[model samples]
Target: MQTPLDTLQHIFGYPSFRGEQEAIIDTLVSGEDALVLMPTGGGKSLCYQIPSLVRPGVGVVISPLIALMQDQVNALNELGVRAGFLNSTLSMEQVRETEQALLNNELDLLYVAPERLLQSRTLDLLDSAPLALFAIDEAHCVAQWGHDFRADYLRLDVLHQRFPQVPRIALTATADVRTREEIVTRLALDEARQFVAGFDRPNIQYRIQQKDNPRRQLLQFLRAEHPNQAGIVYCLSRKKVEQTAEWLCREGFNALPYHAGLPAPLRATHQSRFLREEAVIMVATIAFGMGIDKPDVRFVAHLDLPKSIEAYYQETGRAGRDGEPATALLLYGLEDVVKLRQMMSSSDGAESFKRHEQQRLTAMLGLCEVTSCRRQVLLRYFADTLEEPCGNCDTCLSPPETWDASEPVRKALSCVYRTGQRFGANHLIDVLRGSSAEKILSLGHDRLSTYGIGRDLSAEEWRSIMRQLVAAGYLDVDPEGFGGLRLTEQCRPVLRGDQPVFLRRDIKVPTARPAARRAVEEIPEADMGLWQALRACRKRLADEHGVPPYVIFHDATLRAMLEQKPLEPRQMLAISGVGDSKLERFGADFLDVIREFEYTHS
Candidate 1:
């Protein structure tokens, strides 16, 4: 009778549980429902995975992404966990084979998409099999209003209604207060105990810049910060996704485009290549990246503004999933706001929904303009608190300067009012900067008092003021009217000359400079050879088994082995992520590589 700790160590090769994992597992192992809100790379899987193994029967996992499901099943099979997946991606024969495995109790865990799991055939199969528990991965998709909403996920409540006795756990890496409540209501997990882990991913360094030639800015960030590193660059539109991918490739990066518009087979092929290859940059739209489980993504760069903090957090969380130091760079501008607002307003959703989306986007802009720690603002959105600023973010790294923008804000607001609020930011900025453009001349008579009063500030400066004013609710974009600027009720005090407004000083993007090369994990020169040899061995094995190299051993785990220099099976077993099955299967091979390296060096 192995205890849960024993299973965790002997099977998973981890010495102990991380942050609230043990308690969550304890509840689930005791046959209780639990809703888990953990950050990416926060060990959310172990909460249900451990319970599945410790409980009476096979664990049924409802996964949203087929690729993610396949990856998990592959990694688990490598650990000798007897895992299998049943999804549409599989052939009829493959599905039947997996079905047999489930019915025969040969599998410890089975991963299925929400739609597949809800099928009558699948439900009947599960009803006959001895079930351990139900695990819903990426449970945030259950919220219909969420950015990553899936209609199929809305039908998953039947799992509870059908398997009433089996304990269930619903998990998500990104969920705010509203999304969490939706999950509880939709999943029928209200009675389930809730475990909300801190949303901070300390390993990720946050950086946000006002968009200045966004494509070039992205190229600079990649060249300086993440040369040859595996990363994802998110664009807001499909055309941008394709163009960026093509541009990055021409710039000599291994980049590929992914979006819903791409052929399904092409998208699958690109995703497969990204997961398996090193230093592959995936340029994609918001349509991608919901259930990506890759662990070694070094950066997640945004070429446009994400609609909300939740979307931003979820997208950026894809980076550094292996708990390594990673970077998240966001480049935004006034156009992003105006364009997003236009799209939202034109959407067929109800007015209330549009208003809600507008609020969410406004919050996202506030985050972009934040002068304090990025992590602090991000966490506060999810109702979590960090005691102090995370020193890794751009704000904490190089704090921005604040200035009294009351005069400029007042001028910008007056320009909007005097122009009949019919012009967008570009035209409004032109009016303020006294541009003699034909439209400005034809529409304005060049006679307004506010015109040319903004000559003291640059055009970019005026644009920043208007954007921030909108974010601060002192102004709003009339989405129904071609994204024209309009004064909000909140602007009354400021416009009336009764209040002063301050804003972060917006600066122009700096010229691109060569980045200083960072030391590779600070590994000593002497051990570098052995590290390469270990990687080669892992890669060879991964190729032979048709799995990603990380599926053999994560870079972090390999680094641990390098540091520990394990020379025997018992010593290898003691390494984190070197579970019993791994020790039995490949411990000797890895130990031989280590021992031979020692002999050669000596």
Candidate 2:
């Protein structure tokens, strides 16, 4: 029998197993179920893919989205893998062909939708096949309480009852304790070994800023940190998505909007363009990017607050999927909080469910308003404890100082009260700054004692403070009420000078200037000859495998190996990005090329 390592190299062109991948594969191969909670880009596919190839029969994969299944099938086919997907997109003729291939044992894996899998014909087909295993991708969808819940997922437990002989594996990138339990119970995975990988994506720098002229802030960020890198900017509303995309395009950025409201073909075209084009920014609503496989997104920006932290994390995880550095920026304001709360409160869920959702929303708000390390706060949400702060996040890189704002807050509160609390933050700010705008003069009665008292702080700073105040529960935005600002009871102490209010000063760190656009790094001069030879070999193998060239070995990995000239598998492991999994799986094949080079040179 071939060891898992052998299958890894022969099938996937890698040398060894990634963290817990080897263990999980070993357990599954030993006829045990497994639940894997690996983060995005953490090689979750390999755990099931490798086991499927090594085990006896065809692996049955249940996926939720047709587009996602199509992409996976396309990628596998490119690698010369006998993979096929059954979905609504397939014509009757195509479905017949796929069924014939499956029955004939010509395919290694078959991807099906949950609803399709429950069909009597599909189950009968699987019953006759030499079954290797059952794999559920995005397993968290099983939980009705999860962010992307699907009712069909609850029926997956039927697989355990019908095909008790086949081993099972459920995989998801985002799941908390509650969701995990729900998945296990729903799937009847009482005996499954659980593998939870650390959720830390150290390469991603988390940054949050209060919304003030959000467009300007986003432009500034793009100009400074990621001038020509691929990115996604998420908006809560379709109109905002369209407007933001248009604005970015007017500013000379290659941007497109994607929302459910758009025609399906237009959305598909925009998605395809984003994938193929470099440096394109996609402005989209939450409806976009469920199983996007793009590997080089440099950033993910949110123009509004996400519904919950899980949604936020999953969306942001789309960036830096290639294990390179990236950024996750959230731009939000008081209005976002109120809107989210109102949506949650009005949801047709049980009281307990509503309370749980409210708590989750509150936690997300805490993260946004936190004055400490953004990374630390994020990691804590996933139950990971970090002792020292990560210096890469905005707060850590540039710590903001705080000033006593008790008196100013009092004056601001007084103006709001005197004005009958019928105004938004902008109007209140104008009044405090003694703006002589016609509206302010007419509505504000410039004679108020608070007028012009807050001129010391800039408009941006005031907005930040107000946002924080709202998040901290000292202020509220009436959702059914025109979003008028209202002071909460918590504001009473600060107004009466019984509580100290220290406001964070806005920090103005110099932005990273955009680097001059250069061609994607080619093989360095020192290993030009070896690099050429490797490319030739990679191209030949890729052709044989019928997969994209990068599937065999990414250009960067190949370049690094060639430059370092690793003599052995262990030495290859030392190469950046060549983890133990790749070294064990593909090391010998690469070493053979190196040995040939040495022989020819001599």
Clashes of each: 0, 14
Q: Which tens-of-lDDT digit does each residue in 161-230 have in candidate 1? A: 8889999999998899999999999999989999998799988888888887888888878898789899
Using TM-score as the measure, the top candidate is 1
Clashes of 2: 14
lDDT of 2 by residue, 348-405 (tens): 8998887788778778888887779877888788776678987777778767678887
For each candidate in turn, the TM-score is 0.97, 0.85
Q: Give the residue spans of candidate 1 off by over 4 A.
A: 510-520
Best by lDDT: 1
Candidate 2 regions exceeding 4 Å error are: 338-355, 435-456, 513-549, 561-602
